[model samples]
Target chain A: MTTERVDDATTLTDDERRTLAAIADRLIPAAHGMPSAADVVTDERLRFALNARPDLAEPLRQALRPELGPDLQARLDTLGADEPATLYALQLVIVGAYYTDAGVRDGIGYPGQVAITVRSWEYPQYLEDGLIDAVLARGPVWRDPATGTRARTDNAPNTYAERFGGTPPEGDTHGHDRA
Target chain B: MASEPADVLIIGAGASGAVVALRLAEAGFKVTCLEQGEWLNRADYPGNKLDWELKARKDWATSPNIRGLASDYPIVEDDTPVSPLMYNAVGGSTIIFAGAWPRALPSDFRVRSLDGIADDWPIDYFELLPYFYRTDKQFGISGLPGDPAYPPDTEDAPMPPLPIGAAGLKVARGMTKLGWHWWPEFNSINSTNYDGRRPCVQRSTCQSGCNEGAKASTDLTHWPKAIGLGATLITGARVSRIEHNDKALATGATWIDRDGAEHFQPAKVVVLAANAIGTPRLLLLSGLGNSSGLVGKRLMMHPFANVAGLFEEPLMSWAGQFGDLIESLEFYETDEKRGFVRGARWGLAPTGGPINTALPSRAGEQAWGPDHHLHVRSHLGHGANWGLFAEDLPDEANHITLSDTVTDASGIPAPEVHYRMSDNSRRMLDFHIERAKESMDAAGAYKIEVDRLMRYSGWHLLGTARMGDDPKTSVVDRWNRSHDVKNLYVVDGSCFVTSSGVNPTSTIVAIALRAADHMVETRFEQQVPA
Candidate 1:
């Protein structure tokens, strides 16, 4: 499937196409029932992107030249770490194209843009309610003042003082964190 | 060729220009508005398409240079730390704005007396309050009242505030723990169907133009009102130069039409609402309002940053309006001990779409291969982002000048912006980043990331031709009338004496209303200022 010649406006040589497919696969490899970038027709997307931004195609092709051998992942890792712009160019086309696929969105548990029904505004009670109690329970995340220790308190009006003890850092109220 | 004379001519049908046009037209004046870009219908918005996110990254991009639309003029931004981002449409940058409507604080106007750093505004906040209320009603602003962060006398928003989603709930709880003041954000978007426009359907694509006509861009509010009131609005009419008589009063302007034909419009009064960079560019090009040699000086771009958190639970931040709903202005005023004069407003933001999140982080941290897929999948609905709109003080060195080498399609010299974040701004950003991270941590975020400096978000362009009583130090007076060229006025962000610690759209519109009222009361059907 990866070897198939995808027809596009900007004609990429066979080697360029294969190299891009290999790079796309490495960038977003198929695993855990989710398809890889190549499986989501990234080659066709890249061709279209290249046709639109022709200036980026040559740099991408040049970036792939040194890594044209069997150890494609190693070269790609080096390129990704070393040449960021080239890697970003490749990743932008692949990731952007891959996410557009419905199967990929479903596989990744991304419920795409949902239509919102506008209604009268209401104060969301979930904040007062214990909807995020599980996360809050792992608290005492804020630091203490005199004790120099992290402490947690129930989400109450005077929670900051009850938890931290000894007056919160004055100045910018937020400066307490830096202190 | 010369055209028929009008009672009033306004340049750029943007936030300020549109309001001025509507108000003047309502005052029975023959008003003509020239806009550089065409009117974009709600149907033309990319939010209606499946590839909406893709369009946001390309054709409908916020940066004119990146979008490269025929309507966009080039900007040379090599010297600036952040590139200027704007849209050249009937509604201008408001088309891409997040509808974050925050008025400048009363202290913001008295910065010189309060902070002793920036100069004071010629007109104080009280003078602009009525206009604010009027424009808020027009925009159908939705917000909560009695936010302890603002001054006690602050008026309540017209419409009820938008719902604070799960992510906002987390942040609110976190702020409560930290004892920080947080409130529902004031939005220009309609909470319920009001003024013939639909309510925000929470598409989370406010930056890509609102498809539902919920977001109050001028095209939906002022433009239609102005047109209904018999105002002549010519789209695709780029004003090249402001024409003036021997006495140095503004006659009108010379503009280039869509077909590249030249036109000279003569008006009794001319208003330049062509934004900060644009207004200065025209003034300098035509040699209109440079008597004080400060036409394009003191450019300010609100330096900003974002702090993101990965939560254990599904926050589903991508479901609602992206940058609306909640904000914290606890740190809005100045604090001498914090090492910065003006502070920033922390607002809730989404983690963006799938592709944008999957891309390498600002610090160049890439989550790749099988591990990348797993990482992204796990973080899909479990992320929230908060942003800071920090104040960048006006500096004469940081300004807009005409680039001798760069010219746009119309052969007009492109604006070359030269700006660098001041030490004060850097200190403010550092504090903001720390506070944002602390809030995220308090929200139970296991993995936290901060883009210490937002280099690509130059949304608020202000203070080029600022308002001041001193003509030697300012371009316009208290009424937004150019001191050097009397009948000529500047009603945009260009007239902002100081860039406040918030979005300037609401204030921009309000200032325009106030300026128009002044014009009608004092100068309507009267002789041009001599």
Candidate 2:
């Protein structure tokens, strides 16, 4: 099956495009509701990278030559296993492009970029409300150097401990008390 | 070639050059700044664009070795593991820096006296304190007061620290658990609308240049002010060498413009604020400032590494400002038992954006295909990376010299950086790696990945033309005035006597301010001995 071209800036031939797509697919296979690299137009990203750094294109072209065989998977497997710098560069662009997709980012549960809109410069209320205390209660935690084996001494009213409350959970301090 | 005489001609329009220009011009001296790169406005900055990360990897890369723009000169960095990274622009490296604005510890000034390792700075922290305060106020620094890590001082940041994200909070708790001192990190970014600049909106791409002008890059903070105060800034003017008179004092500098036209700007005083590598290269080319035979010796790039901790919960590592929101200098002072003379400071950093995280590991680990997707899905948001900035001692072997073979677009010889991690640095890295792992473990991270061999981490380039009281041992004196060339001054990181473990921009600006103050007081009106 052929894919629609997303970018026309490349001088890559149809065979070269197919070879690149096959390699990209092998690099980032479809998984977890996310489209495979080839389906999501990663080839365009690869083409752009190749155009920018022309030195990478020849090695890729050589590695994916049809004379290397009709077996596309075998060609990709051989290329991947050989660990050429060209393969790494291709893999980088493929993966980078895949994640940059908004759909892919949402599918993977990443919030992407965010802007702080609150006008005031105060600390986030959640931190002061109870988050610090909750984290501290995950003890017996890493030992504070100033406090030694005991808990911190300067746990004032608005401090990490007092803000979240000073009660340790019953039984062992969970498995997180590594220190 | 326009041949107007200015009272002062600064070679670079970067960090120190901008500061000096502002101060000298404000003192009624005619100052002309010659910058090799173009003056970029907010529109020129890479804003919240979708391809911002690509911009960093391509056009706006911090290293000239990587970017190779026509405006940038090439450098031979193959000899050094950590490449000297900088941006050639009105603001220099600050245009691409993360703006982690930590001051050098007081002891950093007296390393030779206290630790008996590197030479002591000709000036001390106490002497530079007022300038530091001035710089902090100027930059509108954001930080929490009463950080137990620092020695008690009256100086407080202008604003509260940037909001500590979950990753920073987690790391702070981890440090607390490990019995270490951690505090809200000071940043050269405005937390609120200060002066005429807008507050930081947490764009998360400060390294790509702040389009909002929230970060205190000199172009945003000082250049416009200097220009308003009657300073002449000629961009695209690449200085080839400082021209000296028979009296051995610099009269002016000859530079090549963008059209390859050479112009000589005459000045009563010439200041070299062209960064560590650029300044020394020009001085050597001019055949001056080598009376001590130490023009480009004793280079230091603060050796650093990154440790990433993977957690089960999402911490949104890619969404906030890149500054170190939380940091620990508990190990910043000297500790003889660790088999090292000095220590390091580790700060909380994000695991980078999607593209950066998806890029293959520098250690040859493939982050591609189904395995790559699964790995990123499991770790991206859950990862918190720590940057460890360790002090690199001034070793004469680790130096920058003029390359005999390579030349830049200006037909000037490129800088050849020769550097290797000293034994002390290696030991410090090993120690810091272990400590970082412990901190991660304490933070309840299931897995920790440490890139101990950081090959691309040398952003803080320093100590090419060191300052001292003795002319036999140094290039410039305490006032940053060249010992050999009386009217010529070397300001910027090149005059740094020691490379502190923290970021050096704050210290660099403070030093420049102090030097400019001295120049205005004593020599602003002096004429060149024609």
Candidate 3:
């Protein structure tokens, strides 16, 4: 979303905020028992997202500018098709702001990227669960070429000479299956 | 340098360079490592912070081009879809790696013999066994022994395996239903307190650098011991070229510091431990190690794909380390019947945090409109992705060359990659995606989304400077020594003969250990240009 380097973290004016709110609502309206992007793009939440990713400030400002036109869906459609980068900044803040909301995070039952105390690794229960009894029955899956015994197995490649009775398949050094 | 010449000077103090430096220093040889990027503080890692996901999307992104840090150099990826993902810092790419540390199978060595394709490596898999064991401990690896997917020598990891959390168990069940070969992930991240580093706390922000030091990047595991052993590690020293003589012996290297000041550090021997891309760029710049005209040919980049599945359960898919969950090698070997010459491997990983899950870039479309919240709600803690890492057969076409237009901060020409995924790799990816979707189906996923090809997943860089017995066909010999330059060596992934289906870091470190130790074993016969 933060595409290029910028010297300063630009902020949106009051008119820009209104335009972004209208567009954010179109992008992520209240549906399926979820808060809209406009509902989630609160001052507190936007501030949090911007503080975490200050590089997005200029892109966010550019995405919401009035020069992009008044028809919200038309503006978004044009940006989505042609100016995808600007649209990326728009969605990152709108959607990113929506996800960063505490209520939204709680609704999804995601406590965030919290650290967990990892207990000592016990012997894998899969052994007792009989998950690999069938796998072990299939024997080894790899081919050991260092030892000649393993190389002679059914795992060895059936070469073109072995298959079609010719020299090593030639013509394409890049491994293209030339017809 | 102002001081007398060292016994060995290593360029690029990443995993390989760090290993070589420590071993040479312990053997009482004067060793010095020049790293382009500085030593990073643990606090700089985003894993421990509240805004970790925010950082992951921007400054801490895996692609150096996207991260755009001062230490990063431009890799002109215009010719290919696969973007080269690497860090230029002292820890190298490991700083941003997810730590899936599996050694290449024995068959990866003899591709020509077993698979009738790429040239067989001069050295065999068994030669790297001892070094693998040593490096497993050095990096504080963790896994269960006897995976049955590999040789019995596989696993036997130094520590217990990280927990196969709720998500892992779900995927493991899917593999079980399919009667496929699956194993708990083998990783360089610690499961227990190991070598004075903390155990993995399941922070899951592993790709953004592990702040807890649970992951064994070389900065934590090797550089400290090397420096303590009196090995010099000069950070922000970007090497320009290797200085060689008519005798075909490397004298030293000319490097530019942070202030653009150039200096030549002399050494009896020089080791290029820079990653696959950086090493070839330097070799092209130096105009040495190219007698075979293979200094930057035969590139293997292991094209990647992803299949993310959504389940009804909140599996805490964002809670644990990204990839150290479970892996299935059900189809990792060659299968002629599958319409592909080579095969691919699958590792079950957590779909990351809210920002990553909701990003429009992943789906290649806006996650806006009606499905905006529904998208995040479904994938946040309720989905897992099975990442397919397909073996890209070495092709002269998918090679690296010097870019005439693009340059780094110091005006040095950048490396340009001319990579296009082979027909074999595409078929392999297509085949794996179907199987992965089946696995997801067996796991009772309600919906499955496939990123058919990952454009930015060029993490494993290999085979640019291939190693073989014949000088005419390769850049280095069996022991990773440059055939053209007797006193020079390239021990990074550039020495890879074949790109294995699984991760390459484990093999990269083990090979470096063996080559550096071989130096210790044969120091008496070592030659110097000085």
Candidate 4:
């Protein structure tokens, strides 16, 4: 797995870096053609939102420690091991990154599962751009903080429609993932 | 602090407080308005999805600086059996609402009279109509005039109805075929042009916040006008307590800023428009609610669930306003056939983005994973969904109280919301879902997925600090003034006697405008300015 550094304001240590990757992978395990958890979880936008909520990070870290081992442990050690706030932020970013990723689009089983079939609609194009940015921009993190969790760099729906074509429709009829 | 003592002091710049302030201010008393949320501009609303959804790049520092004087509006394990309460900046809940504005039917105001259950509002639709017309004009609502499914129009909408998509058109046609009384729902959004405000661009992001001034949030309408009229809006200021004199009349208010400093604003009249949950919680926290003991009681929410369908062709769900082109009230009337008094309203809505798309269901679902990947290879693009917004009965047992267990940023107990649906509401929901399924089938849905009743889902909270004739029975009088505290007033959904089946923002604005007129004519001038 090719490791890319997460460009948070401060450069995370090697251990911190490994833990982020592991956490992201666990949140979204790559079992299909979408993309690897490692490839999609690196977005910088996703990392920042995780930092905002420290409480959610602890549960994430607790869930991942046994699976990730030393790389994850060293990151914890670097933060002096007791920083619940730090872990909470990291986990939120990891979960958020995993869920919204195009790979998870099929994994989460969104309706009509078809990717962009609408070649000319006004909105699909932006969704296509967002999908490309999500896939190619690599760190799964939101670039702009003001948009909070929904922030993305490609900010245009046309960009997404142009790139990915359309969302793939799900064959299953039970599409409840709406929060 | 002001130079002289006054009768009431209003806190927070939002839907509820703005209405209360306008009411008392119009009544001829000196009224002061306090807003903790930032005063944003039209430009502040960027037309970007990320910017709209996550509020990305919106200045967290410059945003509403109001801290929860009391933290976390908590939902107790016992009281709020299902949902959570969300806190927002200016405009209160109206800021984040989809602007699916609708008026309450005549029966909604007189629940006790028509249904023979629950208490009746001290006032009714007739009392609110003129004000409704005023606010609809001020807010610039849009719809086809006089659809007849609702009350007759007193004034035409500012803009024409938004164009209905294939799905909406299909639903409308199907409803018409079924002889159902269907019309485009009225909303406080500009479909064309109104009073210098632009119309909606069909961006479908109203729930996130309208970047365009089309949606009628208090921040865009009343609060801005109030500020222009010399109302001092202090953003990020969370009011902690309502200071009173020896006579127990409200004199001023104390709030905490983000920086943890306590600030005080002295006003003659105190209006609480923090919304259904916030208004009551704040009044309780201020120690001004016990006289009536109805500070945080009788909280109600219009519980909404959804039913989604997939057609052979694409519905292009995201092509319009968040919710406008579709409206249904097949189950709106009260009847024993449905085993409920009040009814539910259903609408066809576009699905939210991926993160919000998660739902609870049985197996064979393939939206995610390898099967979903394969499914996407065939069916992914065309999607349309329907929403079920049902009226929940007012259970005095459903309420908001201060929780001893949890606290927010400022160390006050979070408002604990204990809400349980009355059996009548459940029966109404079941009947409505069956009707919704029929509509979907009529619209030619090849495959459909409906949701269970989400009793606690919507944050459209109301009726806790209610308006009634008797102080013993309610928190405020018909004019939305507190019966117990002569000078104190409660606006917002909290003052709602019944949680109407429709969105409450338009009604909230109507009540506020009415109250403003009342205040200007009767109350404000009597107070000697300090």
Fraction of native Cα contacts reproduced by each candidate = 0.36, 0.24, 0.55, 0.05
Per-prediction interface RMSD in Å: 11.7, 11.3, 11.9, 19.1
The DockQ of each candidate is: 0.19, 0.17, 0.25, 0.05
Query: What's the best-to-worst order under lDDT?
Result: 3, 1, 2, 4
Q: Considering every candidate listed, which one attains the maximal lDDT?
A: 3
**For residues A1-179, what per-residue lDDT tens digits would candidate 1 score against the true structure?**
01223244345677767777888888788887888787776555665454444445556666667444758777766766788677666677677678877788887777777777744533236423633232333443322222323333444323323322423211111112322
> How good is model 2 by TM-score?
0.89
Could you tell me every candidate's TM-score relative to the true structure? 0.88, 0.89, 0.93, 0.76
lDDT of 2 by residue, A1-179 (tens): 01223244355678877876777787677876668888875556665554444444566566656776767667656767775665655565566556667787788886555667423333354345554444334332122323222223243234454532443211111233312
Candidate 2 vs candidate 3: which has greater lDDT?
Answer: 3
lDDT tens readout by residue for model 2, B341-458: 8788888876667767777654445565667677777777788888999998998888888999999897889989999999899899889889999999999999988888677788
Clashing pairs in 3: none
lDDT of 3 by residue, B114-199 (tens): 77888788887787898999999899887766566676663367876777788888988988888888888888998778888888
Candidate 1 chain A, which ten residues in sequence have the lowest lDDT sum?
A: A167-176
Candidate 2 vs 4: which has more TM-score: 2
As a whole number from 0 to 100, the lDDT of residue B464 in candidate 4 is 82
Q: Write candidate 4's Cα lDDT for B318-418 as tens digits.
A: 55666566777656766666667777777666654443332112122424333433343333334556677677777777877788877656666767767
| DockQ score, prediction 2 | 0.17
